[model samples]
Target: MAGRKRRTLTAPARIVLCLLLAGISGYFLYHCALDVLTTFQLKEQIAQNKSQISELEDEQTALQEQKEKLQDPEYLKYMVRGKYLVTKDGEQVFKLPTTQDDS
Candidate 1:
């Protein structure tokens, strides 16, 4: 009987196969790690943005209340006097002495 021929991979073929598998695995691992890091960063940003949004909303409410107050005649007069140093008709204004002028 004739001897059977054995089929085997050459050394170069084995090396190429190993390198291809390693490259594919490395690519998958790299992308997975990047995705995890990106998700964490996005979650942190969302949390920060939510806090900022709440703070801005609170400020907006306060500003709305102040707007309502300013629409009133009495409050508007008071605010104008305090902010612009304006006086109403026949209203005497008092000025405080500055600390630097005490010398």
Candidate 2:
């Protein structure tokens, strides 16, 4: 093996080798860029989902508090009287009219 001369590539063979290496590198680079973009989009989606979850949790807490308040009979009566305008027996209800302006 020591006595044998080393073999070298010709110009055409070196060109083909370089092109092959470049093609492989380009293929891997394209997939890597796609993966990076997908990761960024998924992270944005996760952040949006997290904010939505927090908003829903806050709404749930508020609804729970409202539910607890509604369980009280006095608060329930007050709400019915104020919102539904329910009057007790032999009670008179009054209404005020508002004027509207047209353009």
Candidate 3:
């Protein structure tokens, strides 16, 4: 037709089209990269929490064992004697030589 010339993509139009597409794709990729980074950070946090929880659980088990041991009268007496160095009546406590040398 006389009025309509053509509807083809010229060189400049193609360049602009390519640039637009690149800009849009770059934005999308940037957002996705941010998400990936956030996910990695969250995973690291979760791993740290898991390790802390494991350590706490181990400490709890040790404390429970200690609690059970403390419930025994003999263990309590032994702890007291070890700490206070007190001996039974009519028992002599000899002072041992010091292992440290006073150089």
Clashes by residue pair, model 2: none
Each candidate's root-mean-square deviation in Å?
A: 4.6, 3.0, 4.3
Give the winner by TM-score: 1 or 2. 2
Task: List runs of model 3 lying over 4 Å from the truth.
Answer: 1-6, 88-91, 95-103
**Best-fitting candidate, scored by lDDT:** 2
Q: Write the per-residue lDDT of candidate 1 for residues 1-103, one digit (tens) a residue.
A: 3798878999999999999999999999999999999999999999999999999999999999999998999999888898788986898888887677566
Q: Model 2: per-residue lDDT, tens digit, 53-85?
A: 999999999999999999999999999987898
Model 1 clashing residue pairs (backbone): none
Model 3 agreement with the true structure over 16-62: per-residue lDDT tens digits: 99999999999999999999999999999999999999999999999
- Evaluated at residue 73, the lDDT of candidate 3 is 97
**Stretches of candidate 2 exceeding 4 Å from the true structure:** 96-103
Which candidate should be chosen as best, given TM-score against the real structure?
2
